[model samples]
Target: MKKYAFAASAATIALAVSGQAFAQESDAFSTALADGAVTELAPVTVTTPLRRPTTVLQSTSTVTVITEDDIEKSAAPDLPSLLKRYPGVNITTNGGQGATSSIVLRGASASQTLVLIDGMRVASATSGTAYISNIPLSSIARVEIVEGAHSAEWGADAIGGVVNIITKDGSTCENGASVCTTVETGVTYPWGGYGTVSTRGVSNSGVNFNIGLSLLGTEGYDFTTADNSVHEDGRDGFLQGAFNFALSKDFLWGRLYTSGLYVRSNPHFDSAPYADWMTGETVYGANEADQTNAAFKVGAEVDHSDTWSSVFELYSAFDYQKNFRDGHPEADTHYDTNRYGLSASTTKEIQAGAALNTFTLGAEAYRETVDSSVEYTETARDVAAVYGQYGLELDALTFNAGLRYDYDEQFGDAVTYNVGLGYELVEGLTARASFSTGFNAPTFNDLYWAYDGSYVGNPDLEAETSKNWEVGLNWAPTDTAAIDLVYYENRIDDMIAYVSDPVTYIGTMENIDKAKVSGVRATYSQMLFDDRLGLDFGFEYRLPKDETDDVYIANQNRLKLTAEASYAATEKLNLNAGIEYVGSRWTNADNIEYTNYAQYQLGAYTLVNLSAIYAIDETANVKFAVENLFDEEYQTAYGYKAPGTTVTLAYRRTF
Candidate 1:
């Protein structure tokens, strides 16, 4: 049954992606697919918040992709809510949209998974990692999620894989020129109303542009036993604009991209467990936090000759953040990062049938400087790296290997490597295994950033290191059926951990040895009913041990299961549903024990959504969607409640 469901889901997605290409053919993911190898389906394209590299597969581990269609149908107000559809991934928050959202992958801490924005490292230099809840997804092109120990490919903070946010660039017009816009406004029964407006335009010069602004504010929802409702004061909005130019066709073929984002949100704290006895309200009720991020990049591909192609890029970014408590300034921070990288890769046809090989080599470097007024700190880190990747295929056997050497001011020198081999036993069956070594260098905040009388930084912290290995089998009996099973183990050496002394009330970061994780993942997709309906299923169990070898590390979960289905009810309408179950988890540091266990198992729930897009005319479109059809009461975080049921109606036109 699971396998059948998985196949159906894949079929539905294939249909959707294939059909959507007719409307917007210039999407990056679609463009990448035009050149890369196509597997059972295709790897999901994700640009984690870090401005490193766009990814398709976990490459080194497990990965999952959630499409833009899935986002619209789910009507999840924010990133945290939408990510709940994944099993091994957990989303916890205090309350409301754009609140403090924590993402725990494979029982790792919220700070373990590094979030990226179009390849740039956007994680807070002070907090180590940024909360995904506060980032809006209005203009998201797609999300690429890689799961596993990836401190190797990326630098610090990617103990788990990475979540890359790849935004949409401008699309080309078929005729003279065109522009489109959509505006939506809706009201929640008890909270309040929200609105969003987006516009995109393309000029005759082959320049594409897009801009969007959105606002969401709501009253709090009822807690398990509290009289004071979950409340959201002030409003949260994201403003983004991007432009793309063709440059030239012969001499310099390139594109220029730029984007700016700002978010100001009212802080919402966790409700006291015993709401009946607590007298004081959650502090920061009147607090506000603001973030401003801007990035600009110019990339060009010049043909030195016919066989060798080169890509050179120059980029710069600036970020500033401020937090206010009780309407007074509490902290302010500013960061500026500059980077320049160049890659020269070439492909040649070695043979026609027996074997083929492709190689890629590149050198890159970046410098980051951080200055803080509230914490009274100034720090800078520079890294220079050289890497190479090679892929070869011989009949039924395939191999991929990569190596990178990086020199950092704080960590000295480090080397990371990954190698994998896959063999095909039959037309539809293949087995593969891989082993990789990765490391995480300490962040600026881990060595600096101190406030109050209770905090300390560790300047001598050793780099966190890991050795990971995995074996798996993939089968596709037919084009309509597929399944994958993978088992993995990871050994982490000198893991970075923070310890707090109660008597002295002091907290400091330290390098602790002895950490390990082992897990198994199963995923399946299938098509049914003449490929009109589809289903997808995924299940994973991970045992991440701390220094004491306990699965309960802070607030991460050990078991996860996720399922999704979609049906093309008609040519004009589609119905989809998704549900995820997160098992019990605990935090020893916080002294919080989840009781009843089974009853407290997040109350297994389901969410059903329906969407219909109709073409009123050649250039006009009408879209309607409903989310949380059952109105189940649940919480992504410990005590914070999610929205009940919601609906959205929108209309768009192109000229």
Candidate 2:
């Protein structure tokens, strides 16, 4: 689940899902507060993950936080590329930038993981995937990644986990400043450039507001190789424009706020068309896609005390896309998916002797609809849910438990729950464990799409479900050093996938079989040399297996390792370097015909990046970065060429 913070006063406010940049004198992934430092962050979610105010160390689930400083240092132009640096995350893209991508968190498929921007959904119902490539990095301030099942708190589509992105609310201006604005521009390799402008201000009447704008475009390279016989090869291009707006006012009763983000992207991809397909000859076409993504929310928070509060909100989000092909207008298709919802919740805290206890109850309702060129049996579905949670913090023990009941118009009813506990074995060391259950609803395209030439839909598909078991430890023996390790196993039942008949080769969606994933993730962070140099290392080993076939999962890596270092070489220069390694993976789901499981595999590779920032003055700086310094050739999938070594140079100024 994601949490938001509401300022008690109008002057001190930040609008986001979670986190504060530079708040972590420690590892930003764990807790934000440093040793003996004041936790002066906004009042609520900058430290919370389960809807109430608490530090990251107090959370029972496996969590990772990427602050604004981390984002700026990565120098990644797209969201997917930036997310790959963290542990427990694996990315698989169809081609180069602006191509479709799958974010497999803890071995969960793209459709099973939930993504939120400022606590609202932006994924398409048809494909069950978010267009993360369309989300500009300039619009984000922080990101939180939670692993394992969490349907008890967030509802469906959380069978795997959740990714919550928080954007700037403009509270980071100079002390007591009434208005502030910043402009940034960059030129990147492989032919691309971008620019963004952001401003945040508060009025004397206690009305706060923020506005941001960004534009980006790239002249990409050929996505496919000549070895494939599908079509001709050429360059692909991508362009996007986006905006963000937020407004809030302090009232005597509560704080009222409204916020939204909108993005329009035009992307070109290699396709087969133009020439008549009935001729049975290969034909190349100039193809492009137009995509629109938007999300908005209006809400109010009322706080009577630090631990007692309530909130009410209404939200709407949608993702629409239409494709264009030369001389094949009739073959081009479009999909429009929309969602609208409302929620209300309240939390109460009680003090009994030395123990603090809290309880929460909430209810939510949402409707989803799809409009497309294909004729389908169903077009709309509705969902309603009620949930309750209880938490206890007594002495060295921390505990949490939640239960939820949901009713779906298409899938009937479901109930999920989780219980977790953390115990302090020593002054700075803690051990924790949890058990949870989650579910994922089948998309309309999977359940009711009309039959096409090669693909069809089955209406008997069930909502995929999962159960997870986890245990971990957090050790912070010193202020500058920290270690976190966790082991988790998740089993999914009735997993949904498209199945093709061996004889006819006609594909239809169905409940394939059972699948399981088990893994261990570990991280170590330290600072040295008068705290001027920082180092962080992360490693993950996972085993993804299909219970039905007793074979390894396809395209899921078993090993991943990363190392990052940052140093202040001088007063004016800051340097950062990183290295990442991903293990080889099989590209085919079935390997019965292959020998020693060696055929149809994507080889492993290592990538290195370097970045530097030189301060021209107090308010100005220049950013220079090199990605894939060695230009290692690799592919996430068959017949697609990954990006090569590239360089990016940029300038930034603050006012």
Candidate 3:
């Protein structure tokens, strides 16, 4: 590990100033810094704070931002790959590219994290998890991640945190119409090649559109070899396509904007059932899964007075999935979900004695419907909520308070609250603390799905609730350097889990007594060498446990560390590298009895990746990247093997 760090540092220094005369380009360097060439702290309009736009520094939350530049420079193959390096995030993929992946935030369950695309919640109603594997990087502009319970602001499934993906919009265009296209090709070790093509553009009239298509096929290696299973030995592949459009227009009284997205993916996987963990017998023939997601949103912002503003939005989204085996429908099973939402919010600002205050009030109503081949007691549900928040800002102190009440058709009603405070400790340092409550309703499958012999749903299950508290410090010692540290503890009650009957040995959804989760996260970023070099480091230690029985949580790492560096080696060439370390974790063995559960530990591993980009001209650029440079073998799950060394080459053009 030390040698890897030294090599990365040496490479960055040697490539950054190889033949350039440092003194001769002082004026150019200054101009570059002034022209936004250097990465600096920029204002972020985050809504997770209080369901209203607020700057990152002013909000009492831990946040991470992934910009367009970061995405482009990362050279990641998918959205999950790009997000895995961020602090407080962990990703588990069952196989190779285009595989089923799950994201865990701050050691929370994958279903506990809320995922939003352009202010619209997009997840499966039955599973309560988003398919991030299908989201193409070509259609995204930026991503904002808030790490902590936020149910007080956004009701339901927010016990872990919020991930808001902002897609590219026409407003990004500066002056005239611009067209951009990208082509990528890559290969996995001992497998096949993958290719992708995408085109995006923005018209001068604030109309933007994007279209992307990708194909990935691999003679995949057996991922279950770790468990001595030879059930699956065939190739796996996937095909995906995505489209996005957005339009905005300014009026005398307000602004109106609308956007839509559609994505489809078909991926092949093994037919082996999870219950046959150690069995080496082959299962069914080749299997494939199809999934589709579509969403549309329209909204308007109006200014009523100098101190008042209002917003109204309407949105609808849907998801559909189906599976097939050997070209024949399997179980005649398919799951389709639809959601519709309407919301309105207003902000009022007032001047008080020696202080300024802002108050926000909002109401939202949403309906979720599930149409599945599997029998269910209930197929549809509705939720309605009203929330309010107040903020006070003084010379060096800031305070916030919020409350929300939610009424569910199936679960009755729930109330949540949050309070926070921030004070300036010194000239360049600030201290902040917050306490919040969260809740997560049982999913349709968890509550209403009919008995399946092995498992059954329990409509009597109650909603899970959580309380969280955290304290943090933010310090910017210099214009080019910043550091953030946070310590947090979270307690959850009535956690949903599967329990088995002792006599019948039948599994059913139930609420666990309680769970305790705690963690500390720290991040540091600095700009060096006349703004030509960038360095970022992050570390997190988490203890997520099931307190009821002192059982270890599955697939949750205890420690995570990430380091990254980038260098603008020349006017047209750039180099970037990153390394990540995931500590040991525990997982349960398959078919284990509920009372005598067996767990196994997976050792820690480190991975390294490097990328280079060269600008051919103002309109064209090429990139090369190597993933898993060290070819380290590791597993996020007990029976799955992670990918190894691979290479990707891409070309992008703008006109």
Which scores better on lDDT, 1 or 3?
A: 3
Put down candidate 1 lDDT per residue, 311-414, tens digits, no spaces.
Answer: 56665555555554443332223343333333333333245477766555666677767766535244777777777766666777777677778788877888
> Which structure is stronger by lDDT: 2 or 3?
2
Best by lDDT: 2
The predicted structure with the larger TM-score, 1 or 3, is 3
Give the Å error, residue 654, model 3. Answer: 0.5
- The list of candidate 2 runs beyond 4 A from truth reads 1-49, 174-176, 229-231, 274-286, 501-505, 592-599
Clashing pairs in 3: none
Task: Tell me, by TM-score, which candidate is best.
Answer: 2
Backbone-clash count (model 2): 0
Ranking by lDDT: 2, 3, 1
Give me candidate 1's TM-score against the actual structure.
0.79
- In order of listing, the candidates' clash counts read 29, 0, 0
Residue-level lDDT tens digits of model 3 in 1-655: 0001111121121111211000000001111242344332234455666788775656777777676666777757678888887778889887666677878777778888888889889899999988888887767877778778899899998898888888876543222347666566656454565666655666567445565556655565555542434346656666777777777776668788888878888877666644435687534533677888888899999989878999999999888888767544433468999999999999999998989899999999999999998889999999999999999889888888999999999988889999988888886577889999998889999999898887788999888999999998877666555667889998889999888999999888898768788999887766677656777778899898888877667778889888888777776778888889999887762322355432367779998988888877655677788878888988776666777776777676554
TM-score of 2: 0.91
Candidate 3 ranges with C-alpha deviation above 4 Å: 1-42, 173-221, 226-230, 273-286, 589-599
TM-scores for all candidates: the values are: 0.79, 0.91, 0.88
Candidate 3: C-alpha RMSD after superposition: 6.3
